[model samples]
Target: MKYRNLGGTGLIVSEIAFGTIPILSGDVPVLPDYYSPNEETAIAIMEHAFKLGCNLYDTAIVPEYGDAEIKLGRFAAHIGREKIIISDKSRYFIGDEMYDAVNRSCKNLDTYANIYFVHQVDENNEDITFGRYGAIDALNELKAEGKIKFTGVASHYYDVLLRGAKDKRVDILQGSGNILERGMLERIESEPLFKEKGFILNKSYAAGILPHFFRIETLLSGVLSYPISSVLVGMGTNEQVDQAMMMKTENYSRPSFSQVMSVLEKSFVPIPCDRCQRCRCKYGTEIHIIFRQYNYYFLGKDYWALRKLDLSINESAAQCKKCTDMSCMKKCPHEINIPETVQMIQRLVEIHIRKSLI
Candidate 1:
């Protein structure tokens, strides 16, 4: 596996990392499972990965729901405990939350994870859960006291991720930038990486749509890993582990101009609304907002936790209906047929709801 300075943290992470979300929660065959790894399976995967020189492992703990760290603790005990580097999440937790997460990570890993992250600090324009710990004031104290070796963040959006990189207190940054979540990448195109720090790129496969999976609908999904430094991936079974290890360096062939444009032309997925006004009244009407409203009215229960990402159509879509305008559709470079897509998304949401209710 190739290794890089990881944004100059003096820590050289393996290019091919074995992400442990599967060991935490087994969610999907393709998506990293969120369950804890079984004993025999854990031993097998860890052994294969280590044998191949892929040593970095990352896991996270949500206050409400997760068993990943506990399983990792057991795996660490089974293994030599100190043979690999561990990266775990500790986002936005306060006094008790920070203390509990710190203690849990140590106990679960059976050793100190070299790095602990503030998980999801900038999601939905929210303050970090570990606001107290995220600053130089607190983290410097903790580092001096040996609470954690290095501090960093795992974020979904680049606006916050970029700010985190500029903060001297923030030593590492992980973002969703696979072939699908390129939104983050586009934002950072002009800016430099966290010089002298690290940038661990996860979701390299674009969730589950990459490699060995069919194309067409899985636009956000991909099998290709970009030319980025380190790409973190998860394995649920032993066979999958082998593929991750033995996979040699990819011979990348950048697409021709037409090919690139064609791919971009075909690969646009509508941004789900979260009631945020980021789009403003630009579309001359609310497009995604309209979809979100119809979604809730039509498919309410099916969207439970998904509600966190809903976009409000009260203004945008309502404006669209009031005026003889449809500017958002024209501005959409993908030619998404915005009005139709929003309506379809609403339709799909209702269909899911109807299935569940029936």
Candidate 2:
């Protein structure tokens, strides 16, 4: 297994870090079978990953219903906590809630986390993040107490995260970047500060959008080409763990950015939206998120992904029909028909929700 320094944290992590999300079972009622492994199976997979030289483990509180943290804590205790690097995330917005979340995580994990992330910061909640009683202050307080070794932010917004990195506010940046989603990649290449900091790349599979055979090899190689510190994969089974190890050990040529991009463009039907967020909906809709979730639903064809889209659809569906001026369609740089796409999603969401209920 190959190891790299996670940004400037001084912690040497495996190139392929084990993400604990798949170990969870029945956490999301909408998708009970979605990556849900039994406790024994989950532990066995994680132990196998450890045998393959994976020392970095990531988990979150709310998403996993605390099951992941509890199980991981038990496993860490069994294996000796000092031997591995454990990272966890909290989704709480306020400082007090953030503090409680971290405390609960530490207690469950049986030790202090190596890195504690302020999870999912984006343009929509930038104000809450940097506010006086926000996650930043909570993380700072935790760091002072020696409850966590470092503070990080996992965000989808490149520009917002880049500002934090430039100000030296965050020690690590966990962002999504793949062949199709290249925002984070663009920032890393152009910004020296971000390149120099600790970066852990996630969503390399684009929520399982990539095909299986070339998924591990292509995605790993593509991410490695950048100055990223680690690539996080939520390996659900022993075979998946083995595949990641094999990809690292094998001497295969890594695909260049252009090559991968060309393949993606040729293989998949083009979606006009580039997620530029330039198209302003008259009803205050988040068009980019809608399209992104649509892509996930199209590729994954899973209830969980569909359910996520349903939540967004609920917010914007009513407003979409009221706007006949089509301002968003005109403003889109890619000239995508925003109203038409929203209508399609509305129909799809209804169909899927009915099926799930039945």
Each model's total of backbone clashes? 43, 1
State the weakest 10-residue window (summed lDDT) of model 2.
25-34
Cα-based lDDT for every prediction = 0.55, 0.75
Estimate, for each residue in 1-358, the C-alpha lDDT of model 1 and write its tens digit: 6665666567777777777766554443323334456666676776778788877777775332255666666666776766777777765435455656676667666667677776666534335443554333344455566766777767765656777777777787777654433444544544665444577777655444344322322322132233344667776666666776666544433333234334444444324332222332454444433543443342322244234224443343344455455555554433455555554554554455346545
What is the TM-score (0 to 1) of candidate 2? 0.81
Model 1 segments more than 4 A misplaced: 25-37, 62-65, 93-96, 123-138, 193-196, 212-228, 250-316, 319-344, 347-357
Task: Summarize candidate 2's per-residue lDDT along 148-263 as a digit string, tens digits.
Answer: 99988888777667866875657888888776565457557667878667888887777666744246787787677777888888788888789876674444245654565456
In candidate 2, position 353 carries an lDDT of 49
- For candidate 1, the TM-score is 0.71
TM-score of each: 0.71, 0.81
- Model 2 gets an lDDT of 0.75
